[model samples]
Target chain A: MNTKILRVNMERLTAEFEELPDAYRSLGGRGLTSAIVAAEVPPECHPLGPRNKLVLAPGIVTGTSAPSSGRLSVGGKSPLTGGIKESNVGSRFAQTLARLGIRAIIVEGQFKEGYKLLAVGKAGAELVDASQWIGQGLYASFERLEEAFRDRVDICGAGVVAEMSARNSGLAFNDLEGRSTRYAGRGGLGAVMASRGLKFIVLDGDGAPGVEVEDKEVFDRGRRKLAEGLKAHDVTKPGGALASYGTNVLINVMNEAGGLPHRNFSSGQDPRAEEVSGERKAELIQKRGGVRPHACHPGCIIQCSEVWTREDGADPMGVLEYESVWALGPNCGIYDLDTIGELNRACNDLGLDTIETGNTLAVVMEGGLLEFGDGAGALRLLEEVRRGTPTGRLLMHGAAFAGTALGVTRVPVVKGQAMPAYDPRAVKGIGIAYATSPMGADHTAGYSIAPEILGVGGKVDPLDPDKGALLRGLQRATAFIDSAGYCLFTAFAVLDFPEALEGMVETVGGVLGTPLTVDDVDAIGKKILDAERTFNAAAGFTQTDDRLPEFMHLETLPPHGHVFDVPAEELDAVLRDG
Target chain B: MMEAPSVTVRLFARLREAAGTSEIALQAQDIRGLLDALVAKAPSVGSELLEADGQLRQAVTVMVNGRNIEFLGGLDTPLRGGDTVAVFPVVAGG
Candidate 1:
């Protein structure tokens, strides 16, 4: 298969196609983005300056019927985390770009004085002047881009928050059904795009340039078997638990395991827990006019997306995921699911990271700005962000920054990125992931839930930090699997059935016309990590940069009454001598 | 009212569906005795929750009041007045 790179110079409104070199054909998605960012962009450059470049690449299995292979990676120097940041978003955009025979799109340099939207399809590329799209929310920008692209296209765009240079801004994308449900929401890459004066990206495939694959029979057989296996598994199958409840399935279980982050990591237990539980959310969806869990991208067998609506059945928003729900629901002390749904919708509309925004709001509330569980106050705070009020500007700067503005020190952040739902003091395995991952404070980066909480692979004690070495190994494996574009949930099957990984690599090699062994898979993963680590090192992140928040070690969590006992020296060993 | 010496041990999922309710009344003091009584009352749930050696199945988690038995006193965790013994089939997915 031949890989093509679409290079767009926003300043001159010029575009060109560059074919993939022999050495780079085997690389795409995380592999391609990390490599390009490492090789071309200077590590010490300002993340949002003209010196930085935003590299967008789809996963290796994207455009193919490989279960959940539609994840797209947006990689650049991060304005938020200040490290090698590659955030994944699942939308029709990745599949559309793959169908256009494009492996990656390297967006370089800032545009001339005004805003513009970059549209790419199989027909070629163009930089359309979009001064009209300035100050628009994500939904409005998407609608305008759709109108300009003749109403049918995949779009990857930023919101007004991004244009305003909010530290928590995100790149929003449409789900399979065209709601803005998918988010390339981590590491503040949207800030990088906004800095380039690129407001939005519209992808239309009026023309088709399907990627080539050798040995059609082998590829077809592999695809059929993989989809069948997805159907067979309860997790990704039709009408499965994930379909019924979305990722909120972890709500009750994680809470039961005493790992749910509640009241800004003050406790693992919530008094009004049932109000936000997955079972309750499922029931609420049935009552409200909302869609149950569905795929974010087409041809995805693992449909774990859900739509949430107001109580009166009006303006149903996108998926209410685990992280967002926890961030908006328990962490902020808001128990009403409708309030959570509205907050989630507001974040998507504003194109802000829900995790970071929710965390920032919680930090402010904890500082006595508002009473805990004040849903009304939360709404008002979000409105302030919309109007770009002074308080709003502080909130937009993210959790750590907001905490500093409030003169509070209990802020939970890793390398400038706010922590997600799980408290590190409770779920130590994922804590290790948050402390060690190149992407700051991202649970999905490593996802220690399978063993630490859910006991899927093997029971790893949640309170024990003895498995630090094992957690790092799993993180490496997970990074490779993610780069390959396979859904992380596939690990459940891959762990039980080794043939699953073999099948995936074989199918990837079959499609790309390159032979890939399991060992090669490991090496590819190591290379991705090396590129990220090298970039972070040059960007001035050191061993001390990886340490968890100071409050985690001092404050003892409730129920278990345990503090983060993993010695900083031991945490340092995660990347040390490796 | 009458001299009824028994207790109801609750099982969830398939075990409960077979036992006909979340809880079952059985007369047993120890874990082994509880299984024997459960098998005497509802044979199907007994087979699902226990192995031939009378040990609990690894796939099933037997908890008393949200605490895993293994983490607590194991089978020796003594039952008391109104003790809620719950059995849950392991359900792991996405």
Candidate 2:
């Protein structure tokens, strides 16, 4: 098997291929990216400085025919969190890179000169001058790149937002339609890529060797078992919850649970939230001639993505995720999908993380920059980011930086990273995950909301403050799935069906030619998380950093009148001994 | 006579589509009765919400006044007049 680690030295403008070390042979996706970042990058180095490195890797089963398994992990020291971070995304970009016989791509060192594009093909890899592409929005930049490169090439890059080295910029990957929408959209990894002076990484897999699977029959068996579970489950099956409504289904679900954060995390519920819901989105999509139940990548059966469009069916914005919708919608007091869709369009164009962008706007509004619920004002503020104005810089540094600058008291963040759509007070289990995740308040790090609020895995009290052990188990298992590169939505089925979990293990085992049972998930996942934790600890993070904002504890959210009352000891318990 | 705890039932996602409306009102004293009334009113959605043995399907998530029935009293949780009851097929997303 060709396990080649491609090392790109930006300062030298050189690309070299190296044999993957035995230590990294078994790791892939988040596991591999975090492993490389922990090993090669200095703990104390400035995130945007010369010493920092960006690592991108496809998950173990990413390139295979495994269903819904096309997640790419982008890892680096985060300028936003000042911790080791792995931002994950789903797109054809991952499958293309993996098929080229590449195990991982390590982008290292800074390039003071203008940006360069790294092109990898069956022939060889080379760096081309990409100065002209710099300072352009991702929409225009991706369009031009598509025209410049062959149709087979999958394009990925940091957009204009990254040119300013903003803390909220994400690395944008092309979706199935060649739109620059899919993203590793958290932890300011795009700024790290920008700092490396690399605007784009284009992978052309034409005529290249595909993924190497050691045991074909075993892989097929596992894939079949998983496919059956997905096909049978109410949430993952076709015409089921996810396929019918897309992930925006959660807008109503979370709102009903009183877990949906509104207006900068001040309240948990908003009657207006249903206005931008997945159900509503689906109806509009049908009426406006947009595509629903769409896949972000090939081989994805869940299809929890959609093409949101204008009422007249003119401009097509990519998927409005539950997080994106809530972040840009009710969280900003803007109920209209058009306003939120435009906000999402701006985020995609600028290559900024929508979750961070929404929270920044909320904090900015709370600081008196605009009134709460000002959708027009929110639209105007994004222009500042394009212009790279002083206010825009503050917004791009993420919610914590903006909240601090504005002296806003209720900055809802953990480790300088803003919280997502779910409020911890209403959905207590996810709050624990938020506080303890190595990635800084990322819901995907440990989504206990499945059990806590949605009743997917198993029913649990959303108000319960005693989930330390449960959160730990969830976080560990999540690390494994993220490493496997399965869309996290697969967890909806995997949780309810034991066969699916076993099937997941077998798929990875089949790919690597190793014997992996369901029993091995915890230890394997823990090893990956241990690497990230060790890096964070070395970078000066303490147990104190693993805590929700003080306001969560002090203030009670309405509707449910719940506060985040999980004990400090419990939060500490989740991350320790990992 | 006074109304039999006239609670409003809100459906979501698949349930709403199946029922052909987002909200419905019915008189029921407890969650079990409300669900029974719900099925009687919207049999298409009712078939999805209840199992063969008449137990609430595992996929159905029920919350009353923004609180899950699990924390309150499960199927027997009482409904009062003017209360809002939310139900769905337990969709999952981060």
Candidate 3:
């Protein structure tokens, strides 16, 4: 099946279908998103202006019968970072779009008059009036869409925060239960979508053409190999670490390592971390009769997601992950999982990025706007965001902006984006990743925690500063994995099992009708990273933008008593070609 | 005879569930001795943390006082009273 690209010009209110460009035929997921943004978008253009474009693409094997490959990449010039950004999410929407033979959808230009929703179906695409959803939160808006568009269709949209043009907003997608919980929640891409007058996007995938595999034999063999490896591995297997407790399992481990950032990076470990840990969360879910070992997308064997419910087990919230737990739980000094879950649900509804919102809330606490560990106060602040109050708007600009506004000099940010759970001062390799990532302090950019804390690939001392080479290798490998549309969690199996790694690459090659070797995967990763770095450089990012917060260098984290002492020269050498 | 050094053995994730507690006080002088005591205390944890040869499992990470054994003296890392020994199985997420 030939791939097609959808170009929607909101200024003209026109939707055009074109053949996939030859230059971009091989690119998919992050590779495709970054390549299009780098080539088409001007580096110095205003991120929320008509010049910026939002490009959405699925992986090469996303729609195929490959396990855990249904991730989507949304890229644009970030209003928050003023650089190239690709935010990723796992949802059935990616598979639906890919099955409709759409390789990428580039939304450009601006419609200042009113809001519109882009609807894509088997026949073609069209723009519809979305005025009613302009200022609505995602939960209410998605419920209305599910009723209007029929529950069988997939949906993605910006929330009320985006409607307010908040820089910390993100794009939300539907989970398996048709709830808008999954998000491409970083880089303020939702503001870009809102700026283009696109409130939501609906996909009518019923009776759509499925992905066509060129070599069924090769695809099946590769799929089988990967499936076997995923089942055999201790961490990725059925009833394994992820399946048993979900991603929150890391809370205890990170706390024990003295790497779980608590109270706005002032400390690394909290005595109450176990209250929000994966094990505790799982126990609560099991006792409350909630679902565990849930899959985020169809054909996902890992089943790391879970349906968390309230105390009485009546209301089913969304899936909970480690990052959300850390950012909203311990980072804010709140140890209760219920409060974190409520905060996470609020962020999902308001179309805000939970990580950024959590960081922002921590900054507000540091500024004495609210007391730390106040779950009720945090919930009230989230309500303010929904209401679009002045203080809420200020907080919605992300932690860096909030920190600057509140005169909090101990802000933990790199390149304007808030750092995630792991304190760089404690986990030094991830610190290097947070500092040097092209996406601005993104944990997923490199994820050195795999080796540094988890011992998934190989054990590395979390406090060691001699990890520039290790971090660089992990970042390159992660780029390739993200491009392939596989869940990052799958790396736990593929890194250790050689057959699984070969199987992932071979499956992509089989789908694209091209031969791909292990070496070629590395090459693709390097090429993608080079494109991103070049784009950031053109956007005026200097070496200074690639350093951690000043406090990280001066303040020593407790337990380990280590500061971020990684040399500047070593950091500069991380992404340098061998 | 000298009194055995007391170390705090901390378990995380599935290991904690297997051990039925987050931490336990054990009397041991080295990392291996602590593991032996841990196995005696919680036999179910031994299967996941150690091999039949009494060596640390490749997937298990053993850290003493917040320092990984690989950076210290491996399984022979000396233990002292009140030292915190954290044992975790291979786990990861983003």
Candidate 4:
């Protein structure tokens, strides 16, 4: 089976398949997405303009029976950050696309005529007019699509926020149960899709040309080795920390370490943190007869995903990840899981990135638009977005815009993107990552919380200032992992198990029909980072754009009473060698 | 016959759930003595926190006065009255 690039030109309403370019043959996922965006898209072009191409690509190992290797990268210039952006999400849509012998789908030009949906299958692909589905939430649109096309196909699309051209909008992908909860939910890529007048993309391939492995013997060997490592590790193993409680497990741990951001970064520790803790959440789910230890995609050994249900076990609100919980819960001074769950559902329905929206709400609360810890007020704020009210439109533009509009100087953001769960003031290494990563305050960009707080990779003092090198190394390694299509959670096992890391690298080699050493893996990651950084540089991003918000340096966080003290020189050193 | 000093022992995550309280006041002179008193006070938490050989479990991170015990003296880290001891199970998330 030969991999092909599927190009959909909304300008001409034509679908064309091109042979994979030799330069892009070896690249997959973020590597391919960033490479295509940098090479084809003019950096100085408006992010939501026709010149900004949106590229979606699956990882190298996707569509294979690789554990947790189902992540898809969506790349484009970000309206939010005004730099290169590669937002990733885990969904079967990526695996299905890979199985169809498609390496990447590049959506270019603009469809000024009307809204349309691009459908791809075993036979071919087509662009169908979809104006009827306009102005509807993603859930209603998806339900209608599934009813019309049958439920077997995987669907991905933008929601109402995209229609409104909200900078904080994100693309949503249907989960295993057809809930549009999984999202490549950052960097305003949804608005980019909306700019092209593409409402949704559906994959309905009946007889997919499955992924071809060059060396089955080597692939099987490496696959088993990696799977064993996942099973052996306490964190990734079945019924372990992740499986049992999901990512929300970090609530109490971060609260205990005084790294969990609370009340809009005013404090680190929240006395009511346990109310939304993983243990309590899991208990509540079990009591409500909801499903636990769930996998987001097929062939995933680490079933870290779960279904959160209402009191009567009706209306499953999708998987509640740690970042969403923290962003909606303690960040806004609300601890009730029901409130967070409702807010999460609202974000998913409206197609707003939860992290950005949560941060935006906190900023508005700080600006005195609403009282902190007011769950009802927060729900009403989300309603304002659904109604497309003027205030909702402002809030939907994300934390930076809302902060600027309200004259609130305490916005916790870097390069326009809001930071995630871990407060950088306390978790110093992550602060370096937040400041330096091209993705703008993305925890998954480096994830120093593993070493600093969780003690996974190696123990780093959470308060240490001398972690520039560590953050840089983690960023390099993570770039490779993202390009390879493995879930970031797999790092917990790969870092501790040498053989697991080797097996993962070897599996890629087996799939590509080439011999790759550990050195090659590092090169691939560095190459991706270089491409991203070069694109951002050409887009006019300087060292100043790579720094955290000014208030982080001025205000000290509570509990530990620490400020983000990582030197500017150290932040600049992150990608210098690359 | 010296009076036993009281240290505030803080539990987080699953440990707090197991102990049914976030903080516990225990009488002990040092870190080891504190653990013994803690296990005696909450028998259900002993297996979760300590191994059969009486060593702290690998998943349990113990900190004395906001400093990791590994940086200080491990289980031998001395604690004075009114010192805060925080214990947590190794947890992670993105």
DockQ of each: 0.23, 0.79, 0.72, 0.53
Q: Which stretches of candidate 1 lie over 4 Å from their true place?
A: A215-218, A576-578, B1-94
Candidate 2: tens digits of C-alpha lDDT, residues A191-231: 99999999999998898798999988888889998999999
Give the Cα error of residue A199 in candidate 1, in Å. 1.1
Q: How do all the candidates rank in terms of TM-score, highest first?
A: 2, 3, 4, 1
- For residue A263, model 3's alpha carbon misses the true position, in angstroms, by 0.9
TM-score (chain A only) for the predictions, listed in order? 0.97, 0.99, 0.99, 0.99
**Cα deviation of A517, candidate 4, in Å:** 1.9
Q: Between candidates 3 and 4, which one is better according to lDDT?
A: 3
Worst 10 residues of 1 chain A by lDDT: A492-501
Instruction: Write the residue-wise lDDT of candidate 1 on B1-94 in tens digits.
Output: 4332455575644565577875676655655566667778788876677778777765465555445566667777656545556565544433
Steric clash pairs (candidate 4): none
C-alpha TM-scores of all predictions: 0.91, 0.99, 0.98, 0.97
Q: By the TM-score metric, which is better: model 3 or model 4?
A: 3
Cα-based lDDT at residue A465, candidate 1: 78
Q: Which residues of candidate 2, in runs, are more than 4 Å off?
A: B1-3
Model 2 deviation from the true structure expressed as Cα RMSD, one decimal place: 1.1
Per-residue lDDT of candidate 1, residues A1-578 (tens digit): 74688988776677899988777778778888888899889999998888899999987778777777887889999889878888887787888888888888999998859887787776688888878877767766676666666766888877778887887888998776566668999888887888888887888877766667765666666666667666765455677546766787666666665678888888887647667877678778888868876778887777788777788877768788888988998998998888998899889888899999889888998988888799889989988888899988888879989899888788989999999878888878888888888889988777777766554566666778776677667777777776777777777556545566677777677777777766776567777887888899999989888789888989888877888888777777765435
